[model samples]
Target chain A: MSQELYTNIAIFVLSILVGFEVISKIPSTLHTPMMSGANAIHGVVVVGTILIALEAHSVLFYVIAFIAVFLASINVSGGYVVTDRMLQMFSKPKKTDDQKQDGGDK
Target chain B: MYLVSAACYVIGLHMMRTPKTARNGNRVSAVGMIIAVIMTFLIVINKHEATMTGSIVLAAGLILGLAYGTIRARTVEMTDMPQLVSLFNAVGGGAAAAIGTFDYLSLTAGSHISFAFSFPVALDLVIGGVTFSGSLIATGKLAGNISGKPISFPGAKLLNAIVVIVIVAAVVLTIGFPVNAWWLVLTLVASLIFGILMTIPIGGADMPVVVSLLNAFTGLAVAMAGFVIDNQALIIAGALVGAAGTILTLQMAAAMNRSVMNIIAGGFGTGDSNSAAAD
Candidate 1:
């Protein structure tokens, strides 16, 4: 493997650990919003879509890149918009590490 | 700049640990994405590249996606959020897979790529295609277009196993051989089939976990795409989602009193009448 792969893998492993820690204390009620939020985060694929479109020479490449961008942006925009909508409905603020049992807010 | 955007994703997710802070977290994450996009645009402009047509195509895609995504997110009923999320996962998966396929095609224009490239690209396409089709089916199940009842053909496990083998072969061939376009095709088709087969066997209370797992798959695929393209931003974002999604999947499964392996390995309603492990 190349040194780049080594670096990427290290970054990848560390990020996963960070990810697990960041949301580990969340309640079950927040699952949907959490998933939606995570969905939005992955929409970073849009970066790839943009770079690909700029470099594509063939019509086929352009078309594929265009479709990728369109889908990825939807993922980014819709993901965050909907997540915020869901989180808005909850009037109570979640206290981290205080309440273990779920559906208490309901 | 890429690292900065990735840091935004991390901090944004950290903020999401609470409800009062979640919306701001989302906003922060979006801002990070904005930074990444602007940085990319500046780089492109500085290069003095991109044909006029390419610019127009990019503009149209951005506009159309932003409009549709924003409008739909605004209007969809709260009850349908899961379905909408699944659809988003589908699109995200398809987009990542498209980038992988495009890159694969470009690289194999007459030569072979090393395992470093083929490994990530092949896996990305497989996961991406699986998440793409599987999320759509999940969306259908959630939206009532398809039966929520678990449905599986006789010998479904064997069939899925066969598809798994095909995918493995394709991946191996992609690495062993000179990066033929056909290997990627095989990989995509097989994984798509695998996704459908695995999802159709799952239904009812298990839907949420399935969707969450697929979300994780999409994230993992995006991360693989990042490795393929050697981009730090994609890797960070993808890894974050993948990790978060996995935790969500396990938590949901636990809430339902089932194990993650059991949820997946149990093959709920696999036509075995005596199998009530999930029932």
Candidate 2:
């Protein structure tokens, strides 16, 4: 195998290890949000779609590239927004007016 | 610069371990993606490889995608987040497979064929095809379009085995005779069918694990495309996604008290009416 391919494989293996370690400690309550967050990160595939567009020469190729770009953009934007919305639910509830007034008096 | 982007992803994912930092982590990841996109555009423009028409098409795609994604993300209920995520996974996987298809066509058309390129293209098609269709089925199940209970028929396992054998044979044929594109197409068709069959029998309680597994398939597919196209950034990003998705899949499976092996075999969660009731 070529050195480049080997390098890529090494990167792949190391990333797997990092992925395991990083996610191992997550609580079950956070699993959904974590999945959503990871979904957004994979939106990095949009970069690949852009690269493909550079080589698209025919109408058919252009169409394919366009769809890819569009789909990837959705993965990126939708993933993040949905994740944010989900995470917001896990945040502490806002203080009521009475609570705020009591704090102010203190 | 890709290294910087990769680092950001790692840090961003790390920060997600806590609720307080998860949102910020997501933003950090987004920033990384923005940088990667801009850098790729600059490189392509500098090489004068992107045509005016191509640029216009790309811009239009971005705008449309951004609008659709924003609306869908904003409107989707939290209860439906898994379904939405499955849909996103479907598109990502489909796009990666499409890239492989385009590359294969162009390569064969030019009469330039090598195992190095052909192997990755074939692998990408199979994995991407499976991910695309499997994710759609998962979405259907999660959204109540399909029964959440495991659906199995007589000889389902035997049929699944035969499909696996056919896919392997097709991949071998593509590698041995790179000029005949039929084998590659056959692989894609069979994998897509297999994807549907594989997911339909998985119970609803396992949809999250299935989604994560499909996400990993997309990652592997993207990484294979990187190999086909000789892009380091694609390789790095795709590998990270694959690894992360795999870990998440395992975690999800464990959370449901099912082994990943059992989940893949397609029968353990079939009779759990109680699980379905809880959902």
Candidate 3:
């Protein structure tokens, strides 16, 4: 009912529209990398959640806070790992079969 | 302050929209961030007086985070960007969880209750906890830290169902008897464990979708936290994140030639197109 809730809802709605438009165009090949990049943005969420958790006075909030931290940590570490793996995939040499196929076409 | 955060979110959304002009997008977001940072500082100064522990800690945390984020931003390649994104998301979720816990302890100081703070606080814990664990598992799947293959065990779906049941029970307990804090704690723990198991079976290729979903969770958590604390800025920021994350999830799902329902229903499987498309 507060102004804050209204603003949050508005922003949330707007962002969803924007996110849909933006992510739709990303190439399939780049999906993983893009996702990894986007995950970093979750940092903002983590920070906000942390701030809120810190303010919690209830045991329920405390439990939620702990889980949030744990989940967020997994997110950060996993995203980093995936991005690195994908990059490694790019760096690796193409299979000899693929090279041979190219030569045969020529 | 809310305006500044909104602007940052707007610019960030703009950047996210125009990936081709990503550098420009980054700049726009950066400007927004600067504004947000200043607003945050101003708020701290205004609310807590000249010098307070919260202010000092906030300043220190911001500095450290900024330094770390900057370094990562500069060095991380576009190819590895998704992982970084996931990592950042985790940090956000973790921070949220931490803040909620601290707030609960501080506000209570001793025994008894406050209905005004109860609902929001509980919401923050559940959503934030899920986001934190879910994001991490998605990151692991994406990075190959966990197997890229879709991992499904006997009764995986059933287990998840049971976990959901437990979470619901916990929620009821939390609301029915706010005085009994232990139920709340149990719920969060169960949720965290559930999050890990939920994302673990998903394959690497499907990670983009998973990340998007987790991002949405994180955002919702933040928004809930804002409600708990009656902070406009936090609410706006959280909502922005949740909405964006959900959209991204949909996009990623589409990119995979799948639907969200199919992705989750299919569970984790090694179904590479080149190798098994014809199968």
Candidate 4:
């Protein structure tokens, strides 16, 4: 095997290990947001599509590449925006005046 | 440069374990994507491979996609997030398949593709095709466009088995006879059908696990495309997605008190009103 291929394999293996370890500790409540975040990260495939689009030669290829670019971009943008919206719901609730008075007594 | 982007992804993903930092992690990952995309564009420009027409097409696509995604993301109810995620998975998988298809066509037109290249191309086409159709079906179920019941007939398993066999055979044939584009097309078609059939029987409750599994399929397809294009960044990013998606799929399955294999084997809950009571 070529050195480049070997390096690629090493990166692939290490990333898998890291991915598993980093995500293992997440609480179940955060699963949906985590999935959304990971979905956005996979949108990095947009870069690959961009590279392919630049090299497209025919009208058919251009059309295909265009759709790919558009779709992957949606994955990136939509994934992030939705994830942000979801995470906002998990933020601390604002303290009302009544709650503040109660806390002061405590 | 890709290494930097990959590092950002790793750190960003790590930070996502907590709700307190998950949004920031998402932004950090998006920044990493921006860097990778800009770098790719710069490299393409430097190599003089980017055409004016291609650039125009890309820009148009990007604007349209950005507008649609932003609007949909903002407007979609939180309850519908799973459906949207399935749609995004479909798009990503389809794009990955398209990449492999274009590469295969060009390689065949010029010269014979090596085994290393041919294998990934075939794998990408199959996995991506399956993901494309499978995700759509998943989205349909979640969106109430299709019944969220287990729609299995007597020969459903047998048919799925046949389709799988045909896909594998077609891939093997295409690798041996790279000039025969028909075999490649057959493989793509079979896989697409298999994807639809596979997802239709899975109930609505299993949609989370199904979507997660499809997400992993898309990641694997992207990794295969990376091999086809010889891009290190794609490989690393795709691997991270695949691994993370698998863990998430398993976790979701566990949350629902189902095994991953049981989920794949057409899932529990027949969608009858009493199905939940029976469980």
Chain A TM-scores of each predicted structure, in the order given, are 0.81, 0.84, 0.60, 0.84
lDDT per residue (tens digit) for residues B54-86 in model 3: 333444444555556656655766665665676
Native-referenced DockQ of model 4:
0.60
* Model 3 chain A weakest lDDT span, ten residues long: A45-54
**Per-residue C-alpha lDDT of model 3 across residues A7-64, encoded as one tens digit per residue:** 6556556655655555556545545444444454444443443344334344555555
Interface DockQ of each model: 0.59, 0.56, 0.17, 0.60
**Any runs in candidate 3 off by more than 4 Å, and if so which?**
A1-42, A45-106, B49-56, B76-79, B109-116, B268-279
Give the alpha carbon lDDT tens digit for every residue of B1-279 in model 4: 698888888888888887667778878888888888889988888899788888888898888887888899999987888899889889888888888887787664535667777888999999999999999999999999999877777667678889999998999987866456677789899999999988988876788889999998888888888888888778888889899989998998898898888777644224432465467
Task: Give the DockQ (C-alpha) for candidate 2.
Answer: 0.56
Per DockQ, what order, best first?
4, 1, 2, 3
Point to the candidate with the largest DockQ: 4
Interface RMSD of each: 1.6, 2.1, 6.3, 1.9
lDDT string, candidate 2, B1-279, tens digits: 588888888898888887667778877877887888889888888898887777877888889998998899899887888899889888878878877877776664425477777888889999989999999999999999999888888777788889999999988887767466677789899989989988988876777888888988888887887787777666776777787888888888888898777787645235453465467
lDDT of model 2 at residue B94?
85
Model 1 whole-model lDDT (C-alpha atoms):
0.87
Task: Rank candidates by lDDT, best first.
Answer: 1, 4, 2, 3
- Estimate, for each residue in B1-279, the C-alpha lDDT of model 1 and write its tens digit: 688888888898888877767888988988998899889888888998888777887888988998899899999998998999999999999999998998998874548678888888988999999999999999999999999888876777688878999999998988788857888889999999888988887888888999999999999999999998888888888988999899989998888898877767655444453465436
Error of 2 at B24 (Å): 0.9
RMSD of 4: 4.0
Please say which candidate is ahead in lDDT: 1 or 2.
1
Q: DockQ of candidate 3?
A: 0.17
Candidate 2 runs further than 4 Å off: A93-106, B110-112, B268-279
Q: What would the TM-scores of all predictions be?
A: 0.93, 0.90, 0.73, 0.92
